[model samples]
Target: MNVKNIFAAVAILAATGSAFAQQTEFVAPDAAFQSRLTRAEVRQDLAQATAEGTTAQRQHDGQDTVYAAGGRSRQDVRAEAIRAASIRHYGDVNDTYFGG
Candidate 1:
């Protein structure tokens, strides 16, 4: 063939070889398929966490949870809400569009 065709074929072959070379092998994790704690140890840890009431909340378990009370009192919250409501809400199209 001509020199141009030979050069084009070499270029295509070089590109294909470079593309295949630019790959990374899969690396397994350091602790692949292995656990530091046995099943019985895991069970014991779960039991201890349950006894201390530190376990994560599950979905729809039908249990009532009471959160700790905040520092603000009910009257304080009501007063803050009233003060906030009294402040004019800017850009409210429904009320006093001309700032009247």
Candidate 2:
């Protein structure tokens, strides 16, 4: 083929390929598989257990000593203290609102 014909053919193929590659719809989750996912309470329980485990591991590994020292900045310590106090006052604040 001539140069012009070859270039037109290539451009048409490229445009058609890209148009066919577009995704136009959301894929819904499988109902049965989704049902097996941890619910909010189960997630909270797992997260709490994981955090407790992490804290215990840190304590066992002498991380508490390092954490107590200058490893954390004054601002970080103050923030942690405020967070602890808030949790004490309100049990547990909403996870979304706690950080912000």
Candidate 3:
């Protein structure tokens, strides 16, 4: 192949390899909620001591948000986390969805 074609093929191969290789190490985004400026480094600090959950992303306050929590079961932690996320998104537990 010509030099230009070789360069193009190398570029495509590098791009694809990088895309697939990136999946080898899963790194969730930082669980840093904008609120709670007074809290510790991350959301895990606020989770109940005995609870066990994972950092996850969700839509909150018109932006992407992340949180971490732990509980007796994964379901319990997920439910609580979602509720907290709702509060962050809507400003109140009872806020109507249409309002936002």
The number of the candidate with the highest lDDT is 1
Q: List runs of model 2 lying over 4 Å from the truth.
A: 1-16, 28-32, 37-44, 51-100
Report lDDT (CA) for all predictions: 0.85, 0.74, 0.67
TM-score of each: 0.31, 0.27, 0.23
* Cα lDDT of model 2 by residue, 1-100, tens digit: 6999999999999999998785688666664455545689778877898988853444375445444347878899999999987763455567567653
**lDDT-based ranking:** 1, 2, 3
lDDT of 2 at 4: 94
- lDDT (0-100) at residue 77 of candidate 3? 81
lDDT of 1 by residue, 1-100 (tens): 6999999999999999888774477766773677889999999999999999999978886666876789999999999999997887666466655455
Of candidates 2 and 1, the better by TM-score = 1
Clashes of each: 0, 0, 5
Per-residue lDDT of 57 in model 3: 43
